[model samples]
Target: MEYIGSRVINASRATIANILADIRRLPEWNPAILSVTAIDPRVLVGKPYSIRAKLPGSPTIIYEQVSTDYVVWHLDGLQAHETGAWKLVSLADQKTEVTHTITHSGAIFRMLAGAFRTVPGLRLDRLQRRAEFGQERAGREN
Candidate 1:
C-alpha cells in the first residue's frame, strides 16, 4: 500500500530539504515522532537511525538517498517495512512544493492500511507549518 501527500511551503527548497535531512530534529516538526537516536549524528546515506514515534514500534530507519531536491528512507519495524520518499520542487518567491510518499508492506500494514492513509497528509501539514513559521510559533498555533 502507498500513501502520498503534498504541500506548498513558504520556504525555499534548500530550507525545507535541510529540515528533512536533519533527522535528529524530526520531533521538532513532526509531532508523531517522539525522538530520534542516530548512530552517527550526521546524516550519511545507508546509516540507520532509530526513531521512537507515537505509534507502537520504534523502527530502525535508514537514509537510502539524499540529494538537494529529494530524500528517500527505509524503515524496518517489527511488523512492517516502509519506504518513504520526499520530493521537493522550487516554486516562485522562495516557495517549495513538497511531496511525501510512503510505500508499506507486510501483513500487519496490509490489514491496517486504511488507518495509515492519513499519516502522510498529517505529517505534511505539520512540516508546512514548521517551515512557514518557526517551531516556537508553530507550537503555539498548534
Candidate 2:
C-alpha cells in the first residue's frame, strides 16, 4: 500500500532537505518516532539506522538515496518492508513544497493499512512546524 502527503513550508528547499536528511533529528519532526539510536548524524546512502517509534517495534531503516532535493529510505521490521521518499520543490518567497510518500508491502501492513494511513500527514505537519519555527517553538506549538 502507498500513502502520500504534502505541505507548503515557509522555508527554503535546502532547509527542508537538510532536515529530512539528518537521521539524528527524526524524533524532532516525526511524531511517530520516539528516538533514534546507533546511527550517524548525517544520513548516508546504504547506511542502516534504527529508530524506536510509537509503533510496536523498532525498524532498521536504510537510506537508498540522498540529495539536496530529495531523499529515499527503506524500513524493514515487524514482518513488513516499507519505503519512504521525500521530495522538495522550491516555491516563491523562500518557501518549499514537500511531498512525502510511503509504500509498504507485507501481510502486517496490509492488515493495518487503515491505522497507518495518517502517518505521513502527521509527520509532514510536524516537519513543517519544525522547519518554519525553531525546535523549541515547534515543541510548544505542538
Candidate 3:
C-alpha cells in the first residue's frame, strides 16, 4: 500500500528542506520521532540512521536522499519491502510544497494505511507552523 500527502509552508525551500532532512532536529518537529542518531549528523545520500521512533517493532531507520527533491527510507525490522519517500518543490515567494509518499507491503500496514495516511499531513501541519512562524506559533501550539 502507498500513502501520499502534500503541504505548502511559508518558508524558503532550503530552510524547510534543511530542517526536514536534518535527522538531529526531526524529533523537535515530528512527535512520532522519539529520537534520531546519524553517524555524521548530516543528511548525505544513502546514509543509514538509527532512529528511535514510535513505530511498530522498529528502532532504526535506513535513510537515503535520492535527490535534492526526493528522499527514500525504510523502517528497519519493519519489512524490507516497505519504504517511504519525500518530495520537496520550491515555490515562488519563499514557499515550498512538500509531498510525502509511503509504500508498505505488509498486510497489517496495508490494512491500516488509511489511518496512517494522515500522519504525514499532521506532521506537515506542525512543520508549516514552525517553519513559517517559528517559536511564536509553535510555542503557542505546545
Which candidate has the highest lDDT of all?
A: 2
Clashes of 3: 0
lDDT of 3: 0.69
Best by TM-score: 2
Tell me the tens digit of each residue's lDDT in model 2 across 56-130: 666788889888688899988787778999998888856888899999887788878777789889989888877
Which stretches of model 3 miss by more than 4 angstroms?
79-82, 135-142
Q: What TM-score does candidate 1 get on C-alpha atoms? A: 0.85
- Candidate 2 Cα outliers beyond 4 Å, as residue runs: 55-58, 135-142
Candidate 3 pairs with clashing backbones: none
Clashing residue pairs, backbone N/CA/C < 3 A, model 2: none
The better candidate by TM-score, 1 or 2, is 2
Model 1 gets an lDDT of 0.80
TM-score per model over all chains: 0.85, 0.86, 0.76
Candidate 2, TM-score vs. the true structure? 0.86
